[model samples]
Target: MVGVPVVLGVRRSAPVPVPGAPDAGAALVDGYGRVHRDLRISLTDRCSLRCTYCMPEQGNEWLARSSILTTDEIVRVAEVAAAAGITTFRLTGGEPLLRADIADVVSRLARITGPGGPVQVAMTTNGIRLPDLLPGLIAAGLARLNISIDTLDRDRFHRLTRRDRLDEVRAGIAAAAASGLRPLKLNAVAMRGINDDELCDLVDYAVTHDAELRFIEQMPLDAGHTWDRDAMVTREEILATLAGRWDLTPVPGRHGAPAERFLLDGGPATVGVIASVTAPFCGDCDRLRLTADGQLRNCLFSTSEYDLLPTLRGTDSRTVDAVLRACVRGKLPGHAINDPSFLQPARGMNAIGG
Candidate 1:
């Protein structure tokens, strides 16, 4: 009999299951009964960007180096999450690329299987330093890449990041695309006056390079207290503006990604809009997040979290599995998309794994 090909970083032995381990099917169930398809891991709670919405203020306390999960610890958690039913795992961070050993983490997660049993391992980066890491990351079993390039103007890029690396970021993106990273997603945050003028160019750049571009609504997350509805570039407005230029054909059906995807005519690449602010898709949110410090967040907007690292580290693997199972069972049906009376979270977007 043939055995499954061993992935380099996975445990040679399977996680010890408890006597009453729930059927793997139960692990995949979503609030709407849609199978959970995505899992995002916050590799770190620190970032170099002072992007107004993500880290709005001056001084902040970050996780100590010791508190952050080690690569091995993270791999174990990935195994548990994968065993439970999450098929897609994407590494996020204050900037996941900031972590020195991010490629190691990627190498490990690429070994796991989802409910259907083979998973897609990906990462979201700010692209500030992708040039140094892109090629090695691809070699480490990374299946896809999403690089956040909020603006194209060099001066505007400096204003947004308080630094200058537009040239490096652009180079990194090109290298990643050339390296055959499928669905090379370019993410931009739409702020009312900040960099909105460059939306067309941002989208056009992606098209010219054979990459996919997505514009995400600025949301109320950790750095959300600085949020103002008046400053929003709603999906309707973005679509209306983009539609005037190109005749678009909507990608049919709910493809389950957070963004409402589309393909543009006379364009080299596709564009997608994530309307989390104007038209939130909370009811269909079937993902769970693990912060850099090992806390599992049920909702992206949630301020409360359960510490999975301590529980997983101090307890036996079987007991840890039970705790993980409880975390999933306790998953909220969906985030509060329609609720207006929400308070600004104490944690910032960088802290929340956005």
Candidate 2:
């Protein structure tokens, strides 16, 4: 998704102590008492498919190869984050699997340890390349996978992504499941007049394939800035559509998870909705984003980003830790979608590390 600027708000809750590190317990704790534990690292800003919602079809600017963080730099920053109570490292990208040494990156990150234990590594990908990359990623200690498969129809998929690799994505999904990537998630962007009609079919596909399905509310992250609120398929509409077809019971105890899960009444099938637009979850969010160029974002919608590449290259680990702590201290309470003054962020989703 694209970055959205958050409106500042007064602190409302008592400061929550970090679990293990008492001395530097506040490293990942923001002003509002939200403790960040998950970090999303964007591996690259280049993707094979020019998805209409994520990037412009033509004249898209690609990041310079020299500007992107190297595998060593990524691991160094992740190590500092791990020590500061961040345990989960989710590798994202314009398309992460696009990186030639992505498995090396995963292996290096998997070696990092925090107060909890060894850090858990996961990835979010377009899945067109998963069939070839899945085995290596799993072998390198990747714990989970979130594959974006927006539509089941081949023609519709091509229409949205401008790519005709839906068959490859399907095979990739099967390979991931067969390889035992537990909690494999399929992310779908719910857009009106497009794939909204396939909600049930998508859920059925997930159930049949033994994967979890999640429908994300389309945000104003398109490269062309053509997103309209009226054109979005809201969370309410998604739930109503599913409720009419299946018996769904809310699955509780989802503290920092972005998706609100539901259990399909008749079987082991379950589906989730990431209601980022209609029902914002910023208050319970515990994520920090690292762009491909080494900028750290406290929130997905944060306008401000702290540059970590210089410190990673020049300074010691202590300085990197300090930079991380300072970034967390300044995190906003929420991404101000409800505020009248809200503005779309300058960077699109591909640049922001969705």
Candidate 3:
């Protein structure tokens, strides 16, 4: 209730019986036997920066304020999801820190105890606002941080985001570290001929700051839909580039993680690569997504979403749980980005909660 606007009153419902009696109360398993325990909830579709790879520089339409989920509504859905076996909750957004009551939201969500134990709460932030918000967020039970840093060069940062906030972002990263946000992760979208030349520099930045770095392959989620496969920096290329500077070895136990982590010999530093386009780890994916407007997405590239706002507002928790389960039941085996039939979702990365 801190930052979210009050809308309709919620009607409480009894606990809904879990679907698939055989796997009842277990992880939300899809038809392909992938048990989902991680949930990414979008806080809002609005952002402060207009990164070219994420959104267009102009003519953007945000979701109606009334349509976005209220704090209580998000908590209700999270309760149902927690009961249904979700144990990891990640808050995302065009920029999650944009929410005025994000700290309050984190506090509410931290109370959800699933079968495994207390749910782990994490966030993927742009980091420009961390200097101001990190303390409250940590106090509110935010367990981890994933900061986005595409480049360290001030001019290139300006060109990429159309914003001159790189210095603020760096300050935020330092603030996050000083605040004891352990295992801090920096995510950089790898694009051919763009920041590809700065891979080493980015790694050095991460190492200097005691943060883990990951390079994610450019996906087709740009607002312009101008993603060119030929212009993408592949996982192989990233690894080779890093290998040239340091001896890299794969780390084990990467089953459910999107990033394939590798250790740099003779140092505590490590790097990860998320080859979503080239490697496709859909088989090991254990994540689900909920858009800001209460639409449930089984995959990042899902063409369709299940609206849960109406149900959350009008019905009981049981019905809401049923809808959540049904959405998981419809999860695709893979994003199918490599398939010739793949089509980009209408919503851009910001709208989709990446």
**Model 3, span 1-354: residue lDDT tens:** 333111121121211223452244556777767778899999999988899889988899999998999999899989888988898899999999999999999999998898778998999999988988888888889999999999999999999999999999999899988887888999999877779999999999998889999999999999899999999999999999999999998898987899999999856789999988888777777899999999999989989999898797885454777788889887766776876778899999999997
Residue-level lDDT of model 2, residues 102-193, one tens digit each, is 99999999989898899999999988888887888888999999999999999998999898999988998888878877988999999899
Runs in model 2 lying further than 4 Å from the true structure: 1-27, 315-318
Alpha carbon lDDT of residue 152, candidate 1? 86
Order of candidate numbers by lDDT, starting with the best? 3, 2, 1
Give the per-residue lDDT of model 1 (tens digit) for 111-208. Answer: 77755677788889887777778888888888988988898888888888776778888897888878877878899998888877778888889987
Stretches of candidate 1 off by over 4 Å are: 1-25, 30-32, 222-224, 266-268, 315-318
Query: What is the clash count for each candidate, in the order shown?
Result: 3, 1, 0
Q: TM-scores across all candidates? A: 0.88, 0.92, 0.92
Q: Give the TM-score of candidate 3.
A: 0.92
Worst lDDT run of 10 residues, candidate 1, spans: 5-14
Candidate 1 yields a Cα-based lDDT of: 0.75
Could you tell me how far off, in angstroms, the CA of residue 204 lies in candidate 3 after the best superposition? Answer: 0.4
Each model's lDDT comes to 0.75, 0.85, 0.87
